[model samples]
Target: MSSTTHNHTDASCIFCKIIAGSIPSMKLFETDKVYAFLDIGPIAPKHCLVIPKWHGAKITDIPDDYLMEIAPALKRIAIASGEENYNLLANAGTIAHQVVMHLHWHFIPKPDEKQGLGVGWPATKPEKKELQRIYDELKQKL
Candidate 1:
C-alpha cells in the first residue's frame, strides 16, 4: 500500500494505473467494465486478480453493473486456470486483509491443503433463542 489514502478516484492507485495501461500487468482477460490479470506475487499457481475499471476502495462502492461484470469474468478466469481446486476471495478493508485499496477479487488455485487460503473458524455455539432473535431481526429488515 502506498501513502495515498483510499478514494473514489486516485491518481496514485496501482490498480487504477493498471486499468489505464500506465502500469504493465500480465493481462488475462478484460471487458469494458472489468480487468483480470495474473497476480505478480501469487499464493498458488495461476493465482489472479479481477478488478473493476472504476475506482472503488470497497466492493459496496462499486456500481452494480461493474460488480455484475466482474463475477462472470472471474468465473471464466478460474475455469481457464486449469485447476479445479480453487478459492474465490475478496476483502473490503484493511482489517479484512485487503492490502490494496482498490476493490478486487482473488482467484487462488488451491492444489492441496498446504497452498492457497488457510482459514480457521473461531466459532461459538449461541443459544437457540439468541439465534432465532438475530434471524428474526435480519428477516424483519429484509
Candidate 2:
C-alpha cells in the first residue's frame, strides 16, 4: 500500500491495527492493495480473512480500483489452502452477523461437513403476486 493509503486507517479498528502492524496476525499473504491473514478463531483449517489495505466499514465504501484486487487475493488464499472446495463469504452489517465493521472476505476451506462455514437455510415462499411486485420494484431500482 502507498504511504498515503496506509494512512487511510482507523485507530479504533482492529483490522486497521492488524494492517498497520500494531496488532500481530498469523500472516498469510498481502499485496499493495489487500492483505490476507489467518483468523484468530478459525472455523476450519486454513480459514482466513482478506481485507483491503484501505479501511472500509462495508463493501460499498471501497472504491472500484481497490475492489479490483480482492478476487485475485481470494484466489491466491484458496489455492494455498490446498482445498478443492471452499467458500468465499462476506458479511455486510451487524444485523447480518458482521462482527468486524471493516470490509473483509472470509476464505473458509470446507474439507468436510463439520468444517468451514455452516448455516441452516430457512426458506419461505410468498404468493406469486407478492414476488412479482418485489421483482418489479427491484428492477426499477436497478
Candidate 3:
C-alpha cells in the first residue's frame, strides 16, 4: 500500500474507520486501493470483507482504482480461507439489503457439503428483439 494519507469522514461508518485505522480489526491484507479483513460477523467459515480504501455506497459509485483492486484482494482472502473456492458477493441497493451503505465485497469460502448463501432468482423475460435493442444501446454508449 502507498503511504498516502486518506481524508476519511467519521460518520459512524465501520469501513471508513477501518481505512482510517480508527477501529481495530483482524487485518488480513492491505494495499493502496483496498483492505482485506476478517468479518466480525461471518456468514460462513473464514468469511472476510474486501473493502475499498475509499468509501462508496454502491459498486457504480466506486472509483476505478477500487474496482481494479478487488481481484487481488479476493485472492488474498481465498488464501486465508485455505484456498477453498469462495463466492464473491456484493449487495447493491436497498432492495438488496445493503446494511453498511459502503461498497464491500464479501469473500465467503465454500469448503464442503454446505448449501452456501441463498439468493432469489428473479426472471426477466424479453423478446430477442428487445434483448438486441438493449445490447445495441449499451454498445453505442460504449
Candidate 4:
C-alpha cells in the first residue's frame, strides 16, 4: 500500500461536514478510511452512501488504496441491510447527476424487482470483429 497521506478536507463539501461531525447523519459504519451512512432521501429501503474519509471531488482524484478499502464496507452494509441484491453506483460529474462534489458510492438494496436503482442503458449488439477492435484499443491503453 502507498504511504501517501491526505488529510485535507473541503470545508464546503457536505460529505466532509458529515465526516467531521459538524453535520448530523445516520451513520451505518465507519472505518479509518471510509464512512457509511443512510441517505436522507433514500431511493430504496436501505439506501446508503459510502465515502472515503479523505476528501476527493472525483474518483480519479482519490487514492487507489482508499477506493479499494470501500469494498469490505459495501459487503458489510449489504449483508446488514438484509438484501441479497443491491446496486452500487458512483456518479462522477454534473452530467452524471452527481450533486455533491465529494466522491461517494451509493448502495441501494433491492429486495424485489420493483425497487432500488433502476437503470436504462441503450446498448447495441456489435459484431465480434468490432468488439475485438474496441478491446484491443482499450488493452493497448492499459
The global C-alpha lDDT for each of the candidates, from Candidate 1 onward, is: 0.85, 0.87, 0.79, 0.86
Kindly list the per-residue Cα lDDT of model 4 for residues 1-142, writing each as its tens digit.
1112445688888998888888999998787788999999988888999999888879988888788978898888888888888899999999999999999999998777788888899999999999999999999999
Q: Which runs of model 1 end up more than 4 angstroms from their true locations? A: 1-8
Q: Write the per-residue lDDT of candidate 2 for residues 1-142, one digit (tens) a residue.
A: 5523556788899988888788999988777888889998989988899998888888889887778999999998877778998999999999999998989999999889999889878999999999999999999999
Best of the candidates, lDDT? 2
Give the per-residue lDDT digits (tens) of candidate 3, residues 85-120: 678899998898899988989988766556456656
Candidate 1: worst-modelled 10 consecutive residues by lDDT:
1-10
Candidate 2 matches the true fold with a TM-score of 0.90
Clashes of 2: 0
Error of 1 at 37 (Å): 0.3
Instruction: Using lDDT as the measure, name the better of candidate 1 and candidate 2.
Output: 2
Each model's TM-score? 0.89, 0.90, 0.84, 0.88
Better of 2 and 3 by TM-score: 2
Residue pairs with backbone atoms closer than 3 Å in model 2 (clashes): none
Worst 10 residues of 4 by lDDT: 1-10
The prediction achieving the highest TM-score against the true structure is 2
lDDT of 1 by residue, 1-142 (tens): 1212334456898998887778999999787788899999998889999998878889778889889988799889877878988889999899989998999999999999998988888999999999999999999999
